[model samples]
Target: KALQFQEAKEKRQKTLAALDTMMKGKDEEAIKKLLEQKQQEEAELQERLGEASQKKQAELMSLREQKEEVMRRIHVVEAILIILCVAFSCSKRRLECNSDKNFDRASSLFTSTN
Candidate 1:
């Protein structure tokens, strides 16, 4: 009976030691998996940031093009206004010259009849 008790105690100790080793291995595996997941998440965040930067650049370029187009239209409208003003001034000068000629001719006729 004494020998059987000693053998049972030794078996229990060996089983406990084996269980402790297995628990340690499981803890190590869980830690490695967490590290891998963190790395993957960081990579995804970086990719999203790059895409956002590209979108912002494109928007800036588009706005610049629109501003240039507006400037061109303003220049064209200004040119048209300048041409119209010049034409108006020339027409006014021609009308004044014609009126002066009529007045002179009438005065000559009146003087000859008298």
Candidate 2:
């Protein structure tokens, strides 16, 4: 009976040790899984940030191009207005000279007729 008790006690110790080892292994596995999940989430967040940065750059470039185009159009309109003003000034001067010349001719004609 003493030998039997010793054998049973040894068997129980071996079973307890095996269960402890298995639980330790499961805990390590759980920790590794959590770590891997966190890493994947971080990588996905980085990717999204990169995409957003690129999109912002593209929008900025487009806006700059549009501003350049608008400035060019404004310059063209200013040039056109300047040209029109100069032409109108020249026309006005020419009309005034022609009127003066006609008045001089009529005065000479009246003097000759008298």
Candidate 3:
């Protein structure tokens, strides 16, 4: 039991010594340099993000303009189609009326002769 206790005490002392060296023996200049480098990287990333956002906004505006132009063209085509349909309907009715009058005149002539 005494041997085990001695071994445990030696291990504890060695662990404490290692912890002290790790905490106090480090270089402060190196740590500051690493922190500054990280901050510069973050700034560059933010600048790139801002630029990308602006580009996307410009693209969206262009697409919106294109959509409006297409809508205007569609409205013009719809108006032309409606006008054509009306004209065709009026001509069809005129032809039907003329044919009916001719048919009536022929029947009247046949009855009068008989």
Candidate 4:
């Protein structure tokens, strides 16, 4: 009877060890699956962020181009206005010089006649 009890105890110990090994394997598998899922989610999130950044960059570029075009048009208008002002000033000075020459000629003629 003593020998039989000893054998039974050994068999029970072996079964318990096998159950422990199976549980450990399942835990490792669960951990691996969780890590894979997390990595996939991270990749998807990064892809979305990249797409959004690209769209924002394109919008910024378009706005910058529009601003440059507007500035160019403004400069053209300013140049035209400056040209007109210069022309007006030159014409006014020419008229004044002509009037002075006419007055001097008239005075000389009158003095000579007297």
- Please estimate how well model 2 matches the true structure, expressed as its whole-model Cα lDDT: 0.76
Q: Candidate 1 on 62-95: residue-level lDDT in tens?
A: 9999998777666555544544544565576755
- lDDT computed for candidate 4: 0.75
Clash total of candidate 4? 0
Best candidate (score: lDDT): 2
Error of 2 at 86 (Å): 1.6
lDDT of 4 by residue, 1-114 (tens): 999999999999999999999999999999999999999999999999999999999999999999987776665555555545545655767655555554555445444434
Ranked by lDDT from best down, the candidates are: 2, 4, 1, 3
lDDT tens string, model 3, 59-103?
A: 999999999877766655555554455456557675555555544
C-alpha lDDT of all candidate models, in order: 0.73, 0.76, 0.72, 0.75
Q: Comparing candidate 1 with candidate 4, which one achieves the higher TM-score?
A: 4
The most accurate candidate by TM-score is 2
> Best to worst by TM-score, what's the order?
2, 4, 1, 3
Off by over 4 Å in 4: 86-114
lDDT of 2 by residue, 1-114 (tens): 999999999999999999999999999999999999999999999999999999999999999999987776665565555545545655767655555554455445444434
